[model samples]
Target: MPESATYALDTRGERMDALEQYFREAARELREPGLALDADPDAVHRFLHLPAVRLQQHMLTPARYARHDDVLPSFVPAEASCAEWILAAEWLAYGDPGMTLASPGPALSTVVLRALADEAQQDWFFGRTSDWPTWAFFALTEPEKGSAATELTARLDADPSGEGWVLSGEKMYIGNGAHARVGVVFCRRATGPWGIEAVMVDTGDPGFHAETLPIIGLRGARISRLRFDGMRIPPERVLGRHRPRSRRGLQGALQAMLWFRPSVAAFALGVGRAACDYVLEQRPALAGAGRAEVDGMIDRLNRLRRLLRDVAAEIDAGSPNTFRVSGVKMRAARLAEDATLLAARLLGPASLVEHPWLDKAYRDVRAFEFMEGTGNIHRRGVFQGLLRDDYFTSRDRDVRPGRVAEGVV
Candidate 1:
């Protein structure tokens, strides 16, 4: 690696620390002010700017790794697993999910670019991107297409003149749709309706329009609609042109799953953690050893956190085992819901819509179920990967990979 490349990798870690401290301070302020239940933008930005969180954001922040030009350890040291990434997210997210959403584009994009893009493209995507903040979303969702990565309408037409590609169609429920300068947009290419390709789209160009949709939860976070009006692309941005047969296309799809589903769980974890803390803080008597339900919640959360950490370690080591990560996603989202509901139940009817934390957390938790391929989609991803072993029963098999679970428990 060049001196600049080495330095950038080193700086990424440093930034993570700095961003982490920033969140610590923000959390401190929230507690002191007794703020309006996660409704502060300044606080959200502070949380976004945390060292751990900011590094997470910058990785995929560009015209799209989106660091575009930097080199990362093909395998992270044993010390830095996916857990470190998700764990840090867990902490910051606990304070505010709205704030925490920004960190992921970096983690997911960096991992994918390093794994997919060619050295030249990867170098440009990473090394050249401005430290100036760029937000991106995995724009695979469509109004008609929910969890199917293969079902998005955003079509990519690759110009055969050895020139570029054109992406047409739109995406909905896109996080950071309005402000995102670039995106990891998935499209059904013109080769066939069956031909699917994931391309990076620049929102600055003509024919590209993104309008954020109004959402009930995570109101501070930008969620929008994207319409690609004959969006043009150059050969340089072709992310998967040299698609490696074994893991290239499939892995990228899995990578998208890896980032968001657990994130859904992470979002839930934040609410659950806050809810538990709220319950413990509000009722001082439960400090005793025999906190059965509280202990159970803690146990479930700890296990899920461990799963996140272990799987992240695998991804960092360049040895991604989606089965393990998918399990974590399953457990995380479910337990998070249970954890939050437990708190709500313990707090009673008035607490369901109560002030400060519970009510907002309850709403945020709902988005987790729908975001990032949804719980049912992940269940399929997990089952497929695990059932690759074939020891599992055929009866559990879903119609389209797996079932789309609805009506959050």
Candidate 2:
């Protein structure tokens, strides 16, 4: 049998074991604060001193770029693998998805910075973040276009004053936008795909405005709408300016999104696991239909967890399978919804009122569908991959060549 087929949820080695232990403890500590954050997103700032939040602040920084003063906890690796990071994200999210998103750190912006920013730009970003618990945003999804790069209406044009560039447009559903001191905004410099470019923006700049949106789920994320009205961006702030135009804008965004898709899937899995754990814990002695339903949910959750771990390992191995990632993300999102719904049903109609944490989990899971990409979006990608016969290729390191493993997806 392929290793992926027999893969278990436990860590593979001592290093990952330690990481899992650290994050599990961190998640436990975050539960109360997470509930607090869900009630009031601003409460996140009060918990920045926590070790988990501090570790997350620098989790993605390369060792060479990381400052000695900003060193993560001794238990954390100087350079953690993608699998480790994904594992940490899942565990932290299991504690409280809202607080996990709300915690101050680079968040999604790290991916874009790594993919597109110059050395100096990276240094500046890391330095600022190291100075304090900084929040950064990746502004790509627009109000109307909804992250469709070709249809992006945001424009970046050369300034008439000739000192820099001017950015103008609106971006909606931007995580941490309302609180981020620094971020990268995607905009078009001219017609066609190559014209698209990403520019660094400081929130303090004139004409840069952000407002937290009223959202029903993941309240701690503080998803916001931003408007850039002739926001001046220095010429040097353009990301990947030294690279080919084709690789600078949408390509960089795509690379970041591809890298992040697995993490997003992991978030959903964490929520599903939380729901399952909640059900099992509260009703320790489930009978007949109740026990069967909980068992079925657990089975599905374990399969998805294996698939996610496999995908994360592939990413760490420098082989990202887009089709598998999309499929896992699609299925994981559904699993989160189903698991939470099952918990509610099994616990009965008054469960939401009686169990606040589970209720919060139910709401937070809804946002995972829209984060990174929507279910509809991923379904289309999976469908396309199937048509191209791209879905069956073995990207798993342990899988034999030309042999598709069962239940790995």
Candidate 3:
């Protein structure tokens, strides 16, 4: 019998090949000398605007976002949502990791809005942006509170007239914040069952200030620090106050992370795959353990990809195993980091100085370590799941630690 694919895609091989070529072309365009680094931000925006928006529409259309609510339509197969995201991330990584803003920002916004917004709010925002590419950001990370953002310091004080509110606080490391058209800014309400509330803030608002913060990797992302200095927003601007089945505050963020972590790993795998391909293509003469390292990395990367697909399958089946997802997240992050390091060791100093793509890949891989959740955090989650006897409980097939089967999810 032929091998079973992890994703259960009807045409996995053909789809991947076609998708790879599509993104490879985009990556080639962006990787052109002086284009990615020196092009005007607006120019880069123009280049990516259409492709980005179309990609988002494809991912969210046909009732796919319902998967986030733990509901999958019968028309969509169990692995369909996961397949969409994995392919999306793979393509984004192929284009340039920085281009990730095209997806994650809009994706998080959609999740937040669906979870917290009323029908009118959704229609107003989603409808308006349906035509042109619009970016939305989830601003939860503050300067002081890195990953532990449960205790919000940002405050949302109600207007004395009982009509609107004033937001006063700062958020840091907001991906695509500087460039986002809309932002879901999370803050603590000053009154009435006070808790973290998400407020929609238009970037053009005078009090909504955003400045791009450059990073070593994913430079094109336009990550920013946002200062909401008494920004006034109408009452309806707030995401609805109704409590979701899941706890609010960190719970919302956690839920987003769970849904997104596997996809995040897919991007990391893309980075690693890019690096590995460079090594194979260059055929660079290597020193001790360099060739062996590259060989080992190939096998490891394949295993990680299969594992990620499996996690996605479980999630699609309406049994999101957080432990499995965390394991995949932790492993994929380490693999990306390790694969890049191995490639660097194989290629020597020349890879960093002479190969811009490889260098970018190296820098991009680092962000995966921190994106969605950190390695330590994911490891902790996996351990906690293990303690609760929930680890791998829903996996379609048994997978022992360090002994994953090929082509298995």
Best candidate (score: TM-score) = 2
Q: In angstroms, give how far residue 173 of model 3 lies from its true place.
A: 0.6
Deviating ranges (above 4 Å) for candidate 3: 1-30, 33-35, 38-42, 49-54, 57-80, 102-105, 190-194, 242-251, 284-290, 394-409
Q: What is the lDDT ranking, best to worst?
A: 2, 3, 1
The TM-score of candidate 1 is 0.75
Query: Over the stretch 46-82, how does candidate 1's per-residue lDDT look in tens digits?
Result: 5433343444554334333333333322212212335
Candidate 2, residues 277-363: lDDT per residue as tens digits? 999899998889999989988898898888888878888888887888898888888899999999999999999999999889989
Candidates arranged by TM-score, highest first: 2, 3, 1
lDDT, model 3, position 326:
84
TM-score versus the correct structure, for each prediction:
0.75, 0.92, 0.81
Best by lDDT: 2
lDDT, candidate 3, 1-409, per-residue tens: 1112422345756655545454444455444421354333344555543343245444553242322221211222222366656766765675566655444235566666655677777765665444345667788888878756566788989877788999999999887788778777888874333467778788888788889886777776667899998889887887775565234544556656767788788888888887887897887665457677787788888877777877877776877888888888888888889888878877777778887777778887898888877888888987887788677544533666665433222
- Model 1: lDDT to the true structure: 0.60
Clashing residue pairs, candidate 2?
A: none
Model 2: what TM-score? 0.92
Clashes of 1: 24
